[model samples]
Target: MTTGQRIAAKRRELDLSQEGLGEALGVSRQSIYKWESDSSLPDVDKLVALSRLFHVSVGWLLGVEEDQEEHISNDLSPAQLKLVEEILSRYQQSSQLTAEQQERVSELVEQKVRESRSPRHRRLRYGAACLALLLVLLAGRSLFARLKELDRQYTDLANSVGNITYSVNSQIGSITSRVEEILKSQNSLVADYATNIQSADLASNTVTFSVRVVPKTYTEGLEILLHADTGDGLVDVPAVPGPGQEFSGQITCPLTDSITLSAVLVDQGTRQTQLLGNYSSLYGSSLPAVGISLLESALLNIPRGEDGLFHVRENYGFLTGLSASVSAVNEDIGQSQVKQVQLGLFRNRALLFWLEPCSRPDNHHGFEKAEQWFHLPSVELDLQEGDELVFAALVTDQYGRQIVTPSLPASRVEGDEITWFSTSFDFPSEPDGWGLAG
Candidate 1:
C-alpha cells in the first residue's frame, strides 16, 4: 500500500478523524487529507511523528513490509529488547540498505545475541572474582591496592567508551539511489565510493583509507596500490566485497610520504592488473563558488550503511565541479544571515572544503536555525549509519583557518533521518558571536 493509504488505514485503526491526526501533527486537516489522497507527501519529520503517534515501525510506514502491524515479543531480556529496538529503529530510518549492509547489521544483532547466550562466561568470571578476593584476604595486601585497581578499571572503561565513539565515527556512510553511470578516467572505471579520513593512532606507522566500492560487473583478485610522492616502492592490499558484493574496507598502506593512491583489478586465476584510478588529496580547500577558503572536518554524521558502515550512495552530485570563482554574498547587519553551504563527499584525498558564512550559536544556549532539519540535496541516500556533515562559511577572519561550530547531532524521527546543524540562533540573552565569518 502507498504511504497515504497506510496513513488512512492507521488513522482508522486509531479511531482518529482527519482533524484529530492533524491536531496531533500540528497541521491543518487539509494537510492530512492531502497526504491520504496522495496529493502530497509528508517530509521526513512528519513521517517520524506519524510512526510514534501510531506506534508503528518506520519500515511499515514506508511500505518496506506488506504487513503494518507490529508483533513485539514480550519475553525479551532488557539488553535484547534494547538491541532489537535500536536495529528496528535503524531499519525504519533507512530502507535503502543493500544486501551486504543488511547482512552486516544482522551479524551485529547476532553478535549481541551470542554475547547474551554466554551465561557461563559471567558465572565463571564471578567465581574467579571470588577466588581472587579470598586470595587477597589471605595474602595481606593493603586495601589501597584494591582501590587503585578499581580506579584503573574505571579509567579503562572511560577509554573503552572513547574507542567506541571513534569506531562509530570511522564507520559511517549513507546509500542514495542515483542515475547509474560510470566515471571513466584515462586508465580506470569508477563506480560509486566514499572517501573519508580515518583517525590515526600513534602506535601504528600506517595510514588507512576507507574505500567503499560497488561494482556492477565481476572482477577477481582486486588489489589497491599506494605510492608516496617521494618515489618510493608500491604498497598493495587486497580489495574487499570482492565479487557479487559491495566493497567497503579500511585499506592500510605504509606511511611514507604517501600522497598518491590507486586501485587495480587482478585476476584470481591469472595475475593481470587493470587500473582503477589514482586520487590525490587536496590539502588546501579552494572555494571559488563561495569565495571562502573552506575549512574541512570529518565530524559529520556517522550515517550507517547497509554493510554496517557509514557511506553516501551517489558519485556525481553537488560535490562535483567548481562552478564560480567569486564567492557571492548579500550581507546584512540588521540581523544575522544564514548562508547556503555546499558540501561534498570525496573518495580519496580531497583538499578543498568550504562552509557558508554563518554565526556560531551557543551550545548550552538554544537551537540554531528555527527549522532544525534540512533535507540533503542528495535524496537517494538511505541514512543507515551517518553522513559526516561538512559546513563551510565565508568568514575571513583568517583565510584557511578551520571553523567548526558545534552543532547538534543527526537524529531520526519516524521514518526520516534528520540532522541538526543550523546557521541561526534564537537566544537573545547571550548577544555574542564566535568565528570570523560574521
Candidate 2:
C-alpha cells in the first residue's frame, strides 16, 4: 500500500481522529489532510517524528518494505516453514474453528517463525519441529484451548500499553499549562509595581509632590526621589513615606522658569535608582504674570560653570551692552490708556537709578510695548562681593496708579566680573516699599 494509505490505516488502528493526530504532530488539521491525501509529503524531521509517534520504522512508513508477515517469512528456514505448515493443518481440522480464528492461527504461525529463527533454536530446528507435531496430535483439543488463552493474554497487554501512553501525554499537557500560568502571573505582578504621580501642587516657592505606589510591601527598603531640572541645575529631594502606599515631599525653588520633574526609586541595598516617570510641565508656573519677556546681553556669551551658573571672568568687565523688553500689560488695558514705563536698578535692595526709555508712538492697535537699551561706556559702579543687583519695571497708568513687575536678581562673585543673572522672580520682602519709583 502507499504511504498515505498506511498512515490512514495506522491512525484508524490507534482510534485517533485526524484532528487528534494533527495535535500530536504539532500541525494543523489541513496539513494532516494533505499528507494523507498524498498532495504533500512530510519533511525529513516530520517523517522521523511520525515514525516515533506511530511506533513504526521510517522505512515501513515510506513503503520501503512489503507486508510485515511476508518480510518475516522470507527469512524462515525450511524446517521452520514445515513446522508452521503442520501446525496450520492441525488447526484447520478443528470443526469449531471460525474464519476469524483461522486468521489468528496464521498470525501465530508468523510469530513462531520469527522466534524459531533465533540462534539458540537453530541447532534443534528439525528435532523441535517433529516433537511439536507429535504433541499437537496427542493433545489436540487441549492444545487449541491453550493457544486461544495465549491470544487473549496478548490482547490484554496491548490495551494496557495504550492506556499508559495516553496517561503520560495527559500529564505532560497539564504540566505545560501550569508553567504558562506561572509566567503570566509573574508578568502581572511586574506591571502592578509601576509608580504614578497622583498630584503636584505649587504654593509660593515650594512645590509639593504626591505619588501612589502599589503593594504596600514594596515600600520597604525603597526610597523615592523627586528631581527637578531648574534650567540651571538639577535639584534632588527625597520623599517621605506617608500612610499606606503614598509618598509626599516638597522642594523650595523658583517656579518661574520651566522645570522638568522626574520620579525615581532608589534601592536601599544597591543604592541604584530606577526612573518611574517624568513630568515636563508642573503647576503651569513657568512664567511670571508680568515681567521681562526677553533679555539680551553680551555677557550671555560666557560659558556656564559646572553648577549651571554663568561665571564671568575678570577680563570681561561690567558695563557690557544690554537690552530689555517689557511684554504687553493686561489684555483689558488698551494702548490708548496713558502710560509711562521706567526701568529701575537696585543695588543691595536699595534703589540706585531709574532710566526711562524714549516711548515710540502707539502704532500697534492692541497693547503697549516698551524697550530700553543701555551702553554704560564710562559709568562704573564698584560692585562688592555678595552684592545683589535687581532690575524692576514701573508702569503708571493715566489715573496715577502704578504697578511694579517682579524683580530679577544677579549676584556678584568675590573676584569675578559677574556671577549669574537669573530670569526667575525674587519678590522683595516688603512689596509696597519696592513699588515706589522714587
Worst 10 residues of 2 by lDDT: 314-323
Q: lDDT of all predictions, in order shown?
A: 0.39, 0.45
lDDT of 1: 0.39
lDDT (Cα, tens digit) per residue for candidate 2, span 54-117: 7765556666644322111123447535744564556456535557655655665565555556
In terms of lDDT, the poorest run of 10 residues in model 1 is 328-337
Question: TM-scores across all candidates?
Answer: 0.21, 0.23
Which residue segments of model 1 deviate by more than 4 Å? 71-438
Question: lDDT (0-100) at residue 46 of candidate 1?
Answer: 75
| Residue 110's lDDT in candidate 1 | 57
- Candidate 1 lDDT at 5 equals 61
lDDT of 2: 0.45
Distance (Å) between predicted and true CA of 406, model 1? 51
